[model samples]
Target: MVARERIITTVRPLDENRIRGSFINCSKGEARRLTLPRLTEIDWSEVDFLGWRDPKAAHNAYLVTPRGGEVIGVALRAAEKHRSAVKQSMCAFCGTIHAATDVTLFAARRAGAAGRLGNTVGTYACADLACGLYLRGKRRPAVHNPVDRAPLEQRIERTLDNLARFLDEVTTDNAR
Candidate 1:
């Protein structure tokens, strides 16, 4: 397991607008469906990274990486909350929506010295992107078109890559 510390810098306050914009731009068309919670509502002093679901696609979450008070990348997430007695997790990437037993979470971890030396956090999502439905106008497989699948996958992949780059940038900056 990796241990990460929340970011706590009194001199540099997080730019809420910048972070929101980064998340919005990274989301592209999905931005229209997302709503960012107020920055003031979050404990910035204790947050190394912040993430939430798209307002439109509440099940689809995103994580933002902060470096030098600027947000660099956004990672997409898929999670599900159950309504039964026991809480369960679902994959956002795959179409298989199941109980916790069937779902697995995948997260990206910070690597290198910055990860090992600084406050580094990991991003997690469903191994399968079932949660993508929230973005595709809540269209389930029964009503989904084959054409929509490819583009959504591409977007999710791009989001993940962007997050990796952000982690790399953080590592590089910390090294300097």
Candidate 2:
């Protein structure tokens, strides 16, 4: 097994250029034809990381390095589950609110050898996108989502940029 060090990366709000570039690059063939979701609809604050579900496989979304948008890593978002937990639950992607029972967790993995060959790992997220709600302040107890998708040239660029920001945060945190 290749020994890898866990790097603490910071999360920042994605800029317009990065978002637009990612949309352009990731949209390949039908993905391009598909109507892109509104950026405003995406809850940016609660987004722990940008991820993608593999093109060949739809089961997993892998945490990607914002730099080069490479599937260099993976992560998961889990809801704090307890019998005495809060009453209102939120979805990670859409920022919708629902009862705790209405929420489910989803898991995804990054595509390519880097992900499958053990260089990286898969992650889990809320099945209903409660994290989205937390980011947008639509719900309480902010949640996160695990996202993954096929390799896109532009997405890779966005991933690189995102990763850089995350790394910077980690470095800063370590110093503190």
Candidate 3:
């Protein structure tokens, strides 16, 4: 049985429309066509952000994160599946160390024309994109974290900043 993890902070759950509307790079028709994972199937209390990969659309992943009382939706493309064993792993977002199989790499299409021209930026992230859960200790790291453990608030701030930087990269203005 999966251990039930508890969230330390209060976070409001989001709906499908809010999730679909937050995409910075995709067309409305594209967003509308994708299926949302069953919200009732998720453990909302343990998730800091909502995330899922569509079973029917393996290349597609979705993230709905609440930032400053507003939910932001990100449409993502997954790297082709590569499974292997490694000695150490650190999530590029939360920086938590885990088993190599627990993290996966993803590339986000840049917004607007840049995406049409095929520009994308990638990051190695928690397989489930549950950095917030790892930060709040709802998910535990499998390996010793190499970075010095700072105050919870400070770590949370850094993690959030990491996410913002990634978002900037996915936006059209930062496209390369």
Candidate with maximal lDDT: 3
Choose the strongest candidate by TM-score: 3
TM-score of 1: 0.38
Order the candidates by TM-score, highest first.
3, 1, 2
Residues 80-128, candidate 1, lDDT per residue (tens digit)? 5344564444333333334554444433323345444443443334333
Judged by whole-model lDDT over C-alpha atoms, candidate 2 comes out at 0.38
TM-score of each: 0.38, 0.33, 0.77
Residue 54, model 2: Cα distance from true site in angstroms: 15
Quick one: RMSD of model 3?
7.5
Off by over 4 Å in 2: 2-27, 33-35, 41-43, 50-101, 105-110, 113-124, 132-138, 141-176
lDDT of each: 0.44, 0.38, 0.73
User: Is candidate 2 or 3 superior in lDDT?
Assistant: 3
Q: How well does candidate 2 match the true structure in TM-score terms? A: 0.33
Model 1 ranges with Cα > 4 A deviation: 1-13, 24-29, 79-176
Score candidate 3 by TM-score against the native. 0.77
Backbone collisions counted per model: 13, 37, 0
* Residue-level lDDT tens digits of model 2 in 8-92: 2333555444433443112234233333234466555455455434444333223433433322333332334457476555443
